[model samples]
Target: MAMFVHLTAAANTPRIRRAGIRADSRGQGGVRGVYCFPVLPSYTLTHQWLRELARFGPKGALSAVHVRLDDAQEVLVGHYRDRAKDAQQWLTAAEAVARVAAQPDPRGWEVVVPRAIGTREVHRIRAVPQVAGWRYLPGAHGTRPCTCFGCRIRGEYGGRRLRERHPHPLDGPPPPVPVLLARIEAAGDPGDPAALRDALHWFGLRRRGPVDRLARLAAHPDPTVRRELVWAVQGWSTPGVAELLDALAEDPHPDVREAVADVRTL
Candidate 1:
């Protein structure tokens, strides 16, 4: 936590001052002046110092500060009435401020202090630190563990494990065809590449189900979806499936065409 700083409103109170030198419009714009604030003695503006202050400060007194450090001069501060839940959010703001200050760039940048910090956002900031010349691992430097899609997949399929399989009784309830089809349709519609990939794999195991609805998605905008769809349709003896593969052979994406070629050979 930060060292507690004694703050007072009295104008006569002595305060510590830091000097900042900057250039101006004049030919000799290099002017310098002391900036004074009622901070505790011996406190320096650093990440560790800021973190400590944020840790001890009352939620009511802290807020998420967003600064577009660029020339646009856009600055926003988020103040949720409930500070208890928002303390971490404000700490993120403090960290961003310290990071920007450390950068040597003359141009400004943009950042937001979210009211609720998600794991994805946490992973993003750590993987790509705001300050220049710094690098760290996932969940490094006290950040939470990264469970982003890429990381999760790496964990699931890395090393000797080719894939995850759960064998079921041959006569068990037909693998919820309607539910899987619905999920596949939903994933194909604005089609996130990863979700579609998982859905396609689901199809691989239950290849005997009716796929007329799923096959309609053959013309999906994303070629990745089309490629996986082609893979899922393999081994079906239906003429419709063959037609689908034949049409995909002419897909604009070379990879999709290549997938169709491979499936044809099989």
Candidate 2:
């Protein structure tokens, strides 16, 4: 048999002890399964997901449910990123353990058993240190933080401090409307597509700006710049934006037209 551990809320201990770990859909495309890590000789690695899991539930402790499974049992195993369909692979339970053990750093490795683990397969349920594992992603500490709106969750622990510390170039919060307008003007005659895109994105975030000045971009040669303009003009309370959007509705570029269609639906 191969040993593995599943980290879960301590409150679930009684139910898990009675009925075992139930399989649930938690991954992309609703892949239903119990997630676990191979039990290695390293104690820290054996319970590396504890701290990460703690961030989800009500304030409480976490526990490690040790399990035993047949060596020949079929399972899916891969790095965290491999959860994507094209990258995932199937292996025997024993093969999963061996693959993870062979890695120099197994921080993001995981295994998914397609079925529930019956109470008979559980070895023991024990409390683990609340701080046993890396938070966010492995080796994330002491490195530059990604302040993108997608990566930084608002109101999460230390989130405000992190954004204040490492502001992302393009994904960070928008400047005032005047600053964005100055940036657009500085892009000059031919216009820098990237800088214009950045400024237009900032305008989109503000959602209300000088639409008359921005309307001139409808004839920009670059389809991408026009597409950004479409996104920026959505929901603006300013005058002439409706006429501007109607003109863009006839753009020859499919992407720009598609963006205008999307804005209309919003």
Candidate 3:
């Protein structure tokens, strides 16, 4: 959403607005006159400007969302490699970018701060903005009545409500296993299939971005992930995916054999 600006010095013009002064370069008033690398504008400025422009332009219009980080104070990542809170900071920053920076304008974001891990595996859980499209909800400033997951669950269980959210927050947590599995069957790529698959075997719910994880599992060097992915695909496999799994029947791993057999039974 940005157009290149080319300005040449006419007579009294001494500075160019295209580039900014850097550490190596010197600036007199607002005019920067020095050669740091080779080009008039360094790559950093171009990248930074592009990011800035994207924030202000229509490209980020669809990314507007309200992310509420619930219990994001104790996320542990690379505990053995990195320190303890490294993953927590990374998760917090990522949520900020996805909710604020990635969007066209400033808006609220739902931040789910997970305190404990039920399993040992690394599940890079994130909260994606599920706000309605701009066409559907014009000038939405994240103050609309939400239907968050906590409300829905409490309603289903016929219990008292705990969180300040709607019964169906557009970006609530995720649905339960059976419900999520049903949703996956209905929509393969609609609500994040890969997330559903990963949660199916472990977390009991769908995740943020599971498609890439599912794809990686499908193409994993290990046999277990590939084999499990076959069943994962069974719930929502297209013809192309079936063909891909069919080719895997020739794998040397016996688990692949078992997985292919399960597919035929399905």
Candidate 4:
């Protein structure tokens, strides 16, 4: 019986047989004349239509909907079993994703999606919607709404277990530098390295920022945070930043000292 299901799936599974679709991590698609956009794996139709499409006839084709987010460099993907199956349910779901992508300031969305394709696998996008007025909220980076199928499954696993498994918030936007710094300070013993890492990254994104407050963190006991500070201070020649780097050069950790000395020698 299991063999029968496996044998039948080959014919009914909506396999993408390489109609010339490619994408890099930066959401650049269409290496060939065929235009494509990045697809979010969780929204793909494979899971939704696996059983239904398999039970249908063998001539069905899989359809993919790619919604280009307002970032232009970002995209959301949705998949369907067949474009014309079950009163167009697959297409409806795909269009719903596009509508959400068009909304103003969508919140609690997944920044990273499940990866469904590999170098050996061929994935194709059949539809690209012209969505507009979509918003990207930086403050909402770490929160994913429970509506998504992936989130539903996760919810079944319970919150405490999930929190234990993933110490860092998996969904949501990058927090402001000040908020990140506050998180680091509040983290206390058995420190939250992730918070410190994010704080450093946030600091690096700005050309000018709170040098004094960040300078105070130079005294943080964690060598990792101090090392990140060293990296972030590079290129800035301000006296405070320079003095901080000099102090870091005397760090007990070899890695921290090395990072402080690694000023752009190029």
**Who wins the TM-score comparison?**
2
> Model 2 misses residue 21 by how many Å?
2.5
**Least accurate 10 contiguous residues by lDDT in model 4:** 1-10
lDDT score, candidate 4, position 227:
88
lDDT of each: 0.41, 0.85, 0.35, 0.43
Query: TM-score for model 1?
Result: 0.34
Clashes of each: 6, 0, 25, 10
- Which pairs of residues clash in candidate 4, taking residues 3 or more apart in a chain or in different chains? 45-79, 140-173, 141-171, 141-172, 141-173, 142-171, 142-172, 142-173, 143-171, 143-172
Quantify how close model 1 is to the true structure by its C-alpha RMSD in Å. 18.8
Q: In candidate 2, what are the lDDT values of residues 1-266, reduced to their tens digit?
A: 99999888889899999999999746434568899999999999988888777766546898889999999998888888775565767899999999999999999888888889999999999988788888778998777767887776656788767766776776666687889889989998558889898899888866478988888788888999999998888878888888999999999999999999999999
TM-scores across all candidates?
A: 0.34, 0.68, 0.24, 0.32
Instruction: Tell me the tens digit of each residue's lDDT in model 1 across 51-79.
Output: 22222333223211111222222222222
Better of 1 and 4 by TM-score: 1
Instruction: Kindly give the stretch of ten consecutive residues in candidate 3 with the minimal lDDT sum.
Output: 1-10
Distance from true location, Cα of 254 in model 1, Å: 0.6
- Please report how far candidate 3 places residue 23 from its true position, in Å: 90
* lDDT per residue as tens, model 3, 32-95: 2221100113233212222222223333322211122232322211111123333323244233
Q: Rank the candidates by TM-score, best first.
A: 2, 1, 4, 3
lDDT of 4 by residue, 1-266 (tens): 00000112232234433322223222112111122322323333212223233233243443443323223222233222122332222122234346435645332222222223322334223431212112122242366523322332332325435544444343322356668668767866545666776677656644455667677667777778888887766755555876787788888999988887676453
RMSD of 3: 22.6
